[model samples]
Target: MFRLAHISDIHLGPLPRLTPRELASKRITGYINWHRNRRKRLFGNILESLVDDIKSAAPDHLAITGDLVNLGARAEMDAVAGWLANVGEPDFVSVVPGNHDAYVPGSFKLACRAWRPYMLGDDKPASSAGENLFPYLRVRDNVALIGVSTAHATPPFMASGVFDRRQARLLRTILRQAADDGLFRVIMIHHPPVRGATQSYKRMLGIGRFSKVLKEAGAELVLHGHTHLETLYRLPGRSGDVPVVCVPSASEAPGGHRPASGYNMLTISGGPGEWNCRLERHGLDAQSSKFELFHSEDL
Candidate 1:
């Protein structure tokens, strides 16, 4: 079986001090929010423990669905680069950006440049420049991981995402190609594809277009992280329903309406029309102060 570990919304904390010039734009709102709220809940120690737990499982590949930083600062990206190194090399890991990763203008480009290794397409030639756009594909074993970017800078108090027409068209092409190869297609995005996954202000803007492409192109599974809650939604596919799974923020402390830090372990085996898969949900246990298995289900 091919084991894949998925985690999202790490929201790494202890944000670096922002200069006066740095706080002169959209980042100012994020900075204030982080200091007043997120700093206390998204603990670094919790994130450290969660990563250690994931490493112990030793999945063949890791999928991190973004929010690796608080304010999308240069220092935050740099810090996450080292953290990504500790998690695994680019070949063993795949990532997609989230709304927080693109907190302001230009920050999204900066993140893409810094985290290129984990986001580039696998089919690119050796001499090809590594600047592949979104809707990149990485083939490993019998699985095709199709990643799309929905992250974009938004105004104050808004955490929305956008997947433009260009990305939607390219994603449809990639999905069909993967299907033709008889591979287990797994679509990864930072925002949930299903409606009502988040509040109106934080909703994905082009989700209707995304869903239209998915229904036509089809996929075996869809993985996302944005709501900071554990959720499951099934969407229409060519032959049947496609499973869409979302996990809580990877660094959320226990208590409150939001659940604790958690991740999804997906095991895929068999082949073609007879595929077999399993999902294991792991989360921090506040009473035990360690990560533990919360549930397991077949998909």
Candidate 2:
């Protein structure tokens, strides 16, 4: 079986410090709340617990969907890299940048500079630019992992992301190639493929076009973050079915009666056309020292 752990939005600590550009862009309604609650030790504790959980689970690979930083600050990226290093193997962990990771104009550059050692593999470059922001692809014995960067620094009140025409085209080509190679293609990004009817303008502005591309190319699964909520949606393709799973923030404060933070473990088995997915949820506990299995999705 190919076991993979999916986690997202672990806004790591030493929080609330913003760049001049980021501070200016905080006029949005939700921005203040994110800053106020995101800086606490609670987030760090939750992250620590998550690392423990991942170590215990011991998945063959780990995929983090993004938002590792609160405001794209250099210190925050450094902190996130340190936290990931403490967790386990860095090469097994693949990540894409979220909107928060690109709060400033050159935020990606800063992230690359700070997190290069962990992000780069033996075959991959230490840093990528422009359309190659998420240029890494791993084809293991049982899984094909594809990561894409959907982070873009937008105007205040507009939390938008664009893969750009070049990246979109390359992604389609990659998907087609992966399908042809008979691999279980898993696409990872920071934005959802379908933003729902109540979608905010600030959330994945070009998802429609993005979805169209994916539908045409085809993939077994697409994982994303940035919604800060748990959601599952199915997208039909001509060749087969694709399931898109969105995970909540791994360290966000619980809202209403909902669990604050959680992650998904996907087990892939069988072969080619007979592959199956089993998704299990792990929630943060009171001590924030471990994650307990809260629920399991029907297989």
Candidate 3:
């Protein structure tokens, strides 16, 4: 079996001291929000413990869905780069950006610069502007991991995502190619694909576009984050229902709403058309600081 571990919304804390000029734009709003809400909600040490648990399991590959930093600052991205290094190398890890990772104008570009290794596909080389890297594909064993970017700068009080027509067209092509190879297609995006997954302000814009593509192209599985809650949603596919699984914030404290640092361990086997998969949810116990199985099911 090919083991894949998925985690998201790490929201690494202890924001680096920033110059007033640094926080002058949209970042200031994130700054206040981080201090007022997220700082208390996120736990850094607990994140390390969770990562350790994942490493102990020794999954063949790790997929992080995003929100690796608070402010999307250069320093924060740099810090997260170090953290990603400890998690695993590019060949062993894949990542997609979240709304927070693109908190302000140009933040996404900065993330592309810092987290390129984890985000770029083997066939797609880096561009000077770092703009067109999304929808990248990395094949591992019999699984094809396609990372899509929904992250973009939004207005204040809005935590939305956008997957434009360009990206959707690209995703459909990848899905087809991967399926042709008899690979288990797994799509990793930072935002939930369907509507009503979150409040209107935080919802993914143009979700209909995504749904249309998925309905036509089909995929074996879809994985996402951004709600900070554990959720499961199945969308229509050509052959059958596709399993969409969401992992809660990987650094969330234990007291908040579904506030458990957790991840999904997906065990996939079987040949191309007859893929057998089981998902096991593991969470860090508050008292023990160790991972415990909370849920498991076949996909």
Tens digits of per-residue lDDT for model 1 on 183-209?
999999988888988898889999899
Report lDDT (CA) for all predictions: 0.88, 0.73, 0.89
Q: Tens digits of per-residue lDDT for model 3 on 1-299?
A: 89999999988879999999888988888899888988887878889989999999999999999788877788989999999998898899999999989988888889999999898886886663355888899999889999999998998888999989999999999999988999999999998998888999988887999888889999999999999878899999878889999998999888886758899999999987788999999987888878899999998
The order by descending lDDT is 3, 1, 2
Clashes of 1: 0
Model 2 Cα lDDT, one tens digit per residue, 1-299 = 88889989887765655555555654333356565654542356666667777778889988999888876777777888777787656667877778878876777778767665545533566455444445457776668888888888776666677766776787788788778888888888888767662257646766776777777998888899888777888887546668888876887655434457788999988776777888888776666545778788754
> Where does candidate 2 stray beyond 4 Å?
16-35, 40-42, 117-123, 255-258, 285-290
- Candidate 1 TM-score, C-alpha based: 0.96
Estimated TM-score for each candidate: 0.96, 0.88, 0.97
lDDT of 1 at 153: 90
In model 3, how many backbone clashes occur? 0
Q: How many residue pairs clash in each candidate?
A: 0, 0, 0
Clashing pairs in 2: none
